[model samples]
Target: MKPAAFDYHRPDSVEEAVSLLAELGEDAKILAGGQSLVPMLSLRLAFFDHLIDISRLDELKGIERRGDALWIGAGTTDATVGADRQVSAAVPLLTRVTPFVGHFQIRNRGTFGGSIAHADPAAEYPTVALTLDAVMEAVSPRGRREIAAADFFTGLWETALEPDEVLTGVRFPLSNSRSGFGVHEFARRHGDFAIAGSVVAVRLEEDRVSHCAIGLMGLGSTPRRAAAAEAAVLGMPLGELDPKQIGELAMSGLDDVPADLQGSASYRARVGAVMTARAWTDAVAEAGGEATHA
Candidate 1:
């Protein structure tokens, strides 16, 4: 199916794009990498009368260190992000998870902000952002505002972004020396959308687990944090930190898991638990602690 006819506008700058969006209101949509949007449009799954092309806007295309966080421009492509040395060093989880975003061709054109704004629960970027508590920065005629990752995603393909607002960049906090990150997802095949997945960051304090963050994907309406599971493992001694039990606790409190053609709710929960456990083990080991049932 072909996308319905629409007006295309190429704006010179982000301010111009924002102005176009504000002026066009509900009729317009921002066109960044077009990896996701183009597919939806081609399938006739979504319709917008006007597409404001901001793909070449220089203002929205850079990666830089901003204080304690790394700032990634909204228009920056996944390929660029995956290849960046600073991103790999400062935010290892993001780099490690990038290979799962899609094929290299797709990653070549899929924008970092586009994936986040698309708000796909199963996508690697959203889970990473949520796991790191990355802050989303947006602009509008009103001015610039920052939204915490927790508050950014509202529901399936939905976000807190207003109609006239444009996502400018995302700020991910830098990892500490004591922290280690890992990601695991259970996809049926390589590069496929995961049925269940987990991204974890763990910080160790001597012989105990000092802090842990767990983000589960493809198991809820939105990428979710395993807060209860994280809390269960906190202060656990290295010898007592069992990844399998951590996995179970991660699945225990999930009430809104989806059941569909991919798998039943119970099946997905099991996968989620396994993924979480594997990721936990990786994270714990990297954090200089060994996880074992003993």
Candidate 2:
């Protein structure tokens, strides 16, 4: 199927792009790498009267570092960041999960901002952002605003971003030697959307857990932090771990999960618990934290 005819405008700068979006309002869809939007357009799932192409806006491309966090431009390709020295050293989780996203060709064109804006619960960035407590910067004709990743995604394919607002970039804090990050997901095939997944970020000090974040995807209406699991693991030494207790805490954290054609709520909950446990194991291994249950 072909998309309906639309007017296209290529903006050279972020200001110009914001102006176009403001003028066109809801009728305009900002084109990033088109990895996600193009398909929707082709299937007529998304209809727009105008396309404000920011793909060429040079201001929105590339990576930068500010203090403790790495600022990734909205237009940066997933493939590029996956191989970047700054990104690899600063936040290896992005590099670790980039290969799991779509394919090489799609990653070459897929923009980080596009993934965040799409707000697909099954996608990697949203989970990563939430797990890392990243910040999203959005610019509009009115002004610029920064939103926490937790507050960015409101629901399925929905976000706190206004129609006229475009995400400029995302800022994720750097991982240090004391930090451990792990991403795990199960899919029928490589690059396919995850059936269930978990991302874990932990800060360990002298073999004791200081801080922990557990983000789950593909089993709920939206990405959510596993607060109960985090609380259970916090201050606990990884060496004296109880897998059953950990699994129960993780399961208890997910009070409400959505049922889908892929699986029932029970099935998803089971997968989620397994993934969460595996993620914890991997994260502890990476952190050099002692293994207790072996």
Candidate 3:
């Protein structure tokens, strides 16, 4: 199937792009890398009368370290982000997860902002953004504002972004020396979506857990943090902690996990538990803490 007919407007600037969006209302859509949108259009799954092309907007492309967080422009490609030394140093979780975001061909054309805006619950970028507490920046006629990753994603493929707002960039907070991050997913094939996955970040001091974050993918309606599991380990000595237990706790909090052809909800919970355990062991090791039972 081919996409429905639509008017294409290539905006010279973000200002012009937003202005067009304001005028076109519900009939308009922003076309960044078009990695996700183009396919949906081709399949006739979505319809938009106007496409505001902002792929060439220089204002939306770059990678740099801000005061503390690493700022990634909305238009930055997955390949560029994966290869950037600064991103690797500041947010290793992102670098580690990039390769799993489909094949290299898709990454070459997929934009960071587009993925976040798409907000697939099982996607690596959204899960990492949630785990690392990244901040999203957007622009619209009402002016610019920052949205915390926690409040950014609202539901299935939906976000807090207003129709007229264009995501400008995202900022991932820099990790400290004591911090370590790990992401693990179980896909059937090399580049397929995960059946279940977990992302873990840890900070250690004096053989005790000081800070921790655990994110779950392919197991819920939205990218979710293992809040109960994180709470269980805070300030707990490494000797008394079991990575397996942590993984179990991660699954204990889930309620709306999806059940489909890939697996039943119970099956997904088990996979999620194992993935969480694996990620926990790696994260603890990297943070200089020992997972004694591992």
User: Compared with the true structure, what per-residue lDDT tens digits does model 2 show for residues 154-270?
Assistant: 999899999889999999998977887778888878999888888888789888899899888886777878888898778987767765456557778565677777787888888
- Candidate 3 residue-wise lDDT at 60: 96
Candidate 1 clashing pairs? none
Better of 1 and 3 by lDDT: 3
Q: What is the full ranking by lDDT, best candidate first? A: 3, 1, 2
| Candidate 1 least-lDDT 10 residues | 285-294
Model 1 Cα lDDT, one tens digit per residue, 176-236: 8778888999888888889999999999988788888999999999999999898987897
Please, what is the whole-model Cα lDDT of each candidate in the order they appear? 0.92, 0.86, 0.93
Give Cα distance to truth, residue 185, candidate 2, Å: 0.4
Off by over 4 Å in 1: none
> After best superposition, candidate 1 residue 254: deviation in angstroms?
1.1
State model 2's lDDT: 0.86
Shift of residue 233 alpha carbon in model 3, Å:
0.3
TM agreement with the true structure for every prediction: 0.98, 0.96, 0.98
RMSD, every candidate, angstroms: 1.0, 1.4, 0.8
